[model samples]
Target: MKVSDLDVPELLDVITKAISPVIFKGIDQDSSPHLWRERMKLHAEIVGRITAVLHCGDEVGPDIGEIIEICTRNMRAGYEQSFSEVLGPGGSLSKIRKP
Candidate 1:
């Protein structure tokens, strides 16, 4: 499904359910509203990027397999930074030249 078609709360719920006790430990009860909002925004952004990459279907676009690798192997920058790193620059996406 397109990222625009996604539901934030539902997406969060699915992720939370899928990961179990390994939850996004990035947020907590004491987290400030502003901090939590920023984190949530980042979560949405990364999800959108991943959805975009998977749907692009262009050879030059980022690979879904590689993106999964990053998600599983790297937790240093959370999700957004790591996905963006895999995507390289926005220019790289622009270089796709739709087929």
Candidate 2:
């Protein structure tokens, strides 16, 4: 099924359900301020990657496995760059975090 085939709510529901476990797992693994920032960065990277893939008109099969495969493949790419861009010296995240 293509992402466009799903209604807004259904798309959100499916994406949230699919991504929640990963978010929760990261949350469970760390509670420090630095790790919390890392987790949030990772979450943003994941959602951004998924959105990019969907936007590119990729085909997703009905099976959950296929959906996961797509998500995994997209999520694994460019993360280090994204992480550095967000958390590096003078990154936007630092500006936002500062009062």
Candidate 3:
């Protein structure tokens, strides 16, 4: 069955779960606008693609990891740009937290 066969709310819930980590931050949103903007952009991209995949139903057989990888790739580029803006010339990666 096509994803469109599902109700709107169900479709949204599936999409939300797929993109949960990106959209579900708490106080971070209140404190960090720049980071939040990049995150939201990634969230939107992931959700949009996931939604399309779902809408395509069995034809494409999309995987969540594929969606995440795409989001991460785009997000990384956005983050690099955001870091450049915030850190300034030769600001160094010291400000970024080490994982």
Candidate 4:
């Protein structure tokens, strides 16, 4: 479906789903601190670009900022959950090592 066809809430869901998997996959596959840092930088740039586009669009307008915030929070929560699952209790990205 076209992005234009989606409402604000639907757009948030679509964006989160589309982006979160890539981040989770990166977290899972990154074998070194440098790789992980680079991947995260790229991800941040992508998300920033997307947010800028959404903010400029007449359809999203003023609500875009809040939507982006919520989307980011959801993505962070998903990352933390994935890390916890893979690393067990008290697990965090800092504890991840090449394996």
TM-score of each: 0.36, 0.43, 0.43, 0.43
Off by over 4 Å in 3: 1-5, 21-30, 61-99
* Model 3 lDDT per residue over 1-99, tens place: 655566755876776676666464662413454565555566656665665565555566546567656655665566567656645544443255455
Clashing pairs in 2: none
Evaluated against the true structure, the overall lDDT of model 1 is 0.48
Q: Show pairs that collide, candidate 1.
A: none
Pick out the ten consecutive residues of candidate 3 with the lowest summed lDDT: 86-95
User: Model 4, poorest ten-residue lDDT window?
Assistant: 85-94
Name the best candidate (by TM-score): 3
In every candidate, how many clashes are there?
0, 0, 0, 0
How many clashing residue pairs, candidate 2? 0
* RMSD of each predicted structure: 15.9, 7.5, 8.5, 6.0
Query: In model 4, which runs have C-alpha deviations exceeding 4 angstroms?
Result: 1-10, 23-30, 59-91, 96-99
Give the lDDT of residue 19 in candidate 4: 81
Between prediction 1 and prediction 3, the one with superior TM-score is 3
Clashing pairs in 3: none
Candidate 1 lDDT over 24-92, as tens digits, reads 466554545445445545555555454444443444344766665454334325544644543445523
